[model samples]
Target: MRKGKLYLIPTVIAEETQAVVIPPHILQALPGIQYFLAEDIRTARRYLSSLKVYESIEPLIFEVLNKNTKADQLKKFFEPVFQGNDLGILSESGCPGVADPGSLAVKFAHEHDIQVVPLVGPSSILLALMASGMNGQRFAFHGYLPIDGKDASAIVKTLEKESRSKNQTQIFIETPYRNNTLMAVLMKSLADDTQLCIAVDVTGKDESIRSYSVKKWKSIPVTFPKSPAIFLFLSH
Candidate 1:
């Protein structure tokens, strides 16, 4: 029997922006995928249903794959693929395997011999970088900074030092609720001339992507929103 392919599916970054961010091809590919690994099964069902591609999603099989998913349990998750059913890995937001936990499955697919396909869609990281007007040629994505204020501050400063020397754009994200705390640290840790870009709600109606120096950011007296956000900075 032929083996199944692994599809790295991308979901919308914001709510109700499906038509704006999801392409026609992604919808076309959905009818053939009945087995999915998602961060949140309920959200995955709702998202797929919103596309109106299926008469009923009741027949679909969804298995959890999140930060808590264990490496030892991945073999069982891939069983359907081994049985010749194409498997789709869905992220809670953005492209699967980029900053999402879907990377674990992708790595497992590679180790086996499954063909991995990535569907094009909005990625908050890339979208933010595109709008930030930062150094696109040399950029690094540090997934999440340390949660502790002091540790996060130290890491930010270290990244800033590296950015200055290498002229590379440093990118990172913060948990939605911790947005304000991270923003405060960024303002406090970075230098006056260091350019910072805060891209919030990328590809959404309320999308905002602004770049300013740390000195300017200090004067703005702004409060970060409780929404998915990307932070990028360049120091030269």
Candidate 2:
């Protein structure tokens, strides 16, 4: 009989950077683990090292896509998680499956009746929404905007108008490198007085979050931060 192992999932939230709270729970469980299934193997190693843990952690790559290769990836990646061997699912940044990789593994675990535990910590999306000053009751994370050079003008217009009509905060994000480009599109396409919020490097040493009207960013020449960030547009 195979003994089912409990997974000690770690959140890559900003608060987890220090050796405290939620991170310690996962960090303590890393030693003598059967395996480690991570979105990025290198990042997982770094997180372990940051905590002064020197266990020989094995790597299992998990994907977010829905292709055949994705299933193979999950099988190859998360097989140990179900068979009584503890395998931790970690996001490169933030919580897994919340705009990060690891949902597929969770789904697999659930399907196989494997207990999945999520350790809570700093969440950039929730943190951004709480600071947005928008309607908290009604909100949607639209993930990343089009990256294939799609009409960003039309996308922003639609998001702005929809938010205004529904009285909801439309939240979205982009890659760290394309931060400025998204800001430009938001200013040009959205209304002049639209409220925009940018939460950059949420829990890091250089963290910054600014909320202002679109017009305010105009004169300021909004060059979005190059660090990891979350942006939200409010219409209330």
- Highest TM-score model number: 1
User: Which ten residues in a row are the worst by lDDT in model 2?
Assistant: 60-69
Q: Give the per-residue lDDT of model 2 (tens digit) for 37-113.
A: 66666766667666666643344333233222365566666556545676666676767668765677778778777
What shift in Å separates residue 161 of candidate 1 from its native position after superposition? 0.6
As for candidate 2, its clashing pairs are: 3-84, 4-84, 5-84
- In order of listing, the candidates' clash counts read 0, 3
- Residue 188, model 2: Cα distance from true site in angstroms: 0.6
The local lDDT score (0 to 100) that residue 212 gets in candidate 2 is 91
Which whole-number lDDT from 0 to 100 does residue 227 have in model 1?
A: 89
Candidates' C-alpha lDDT: 0.94, 0.70
Off by over 4 Å in 1: none
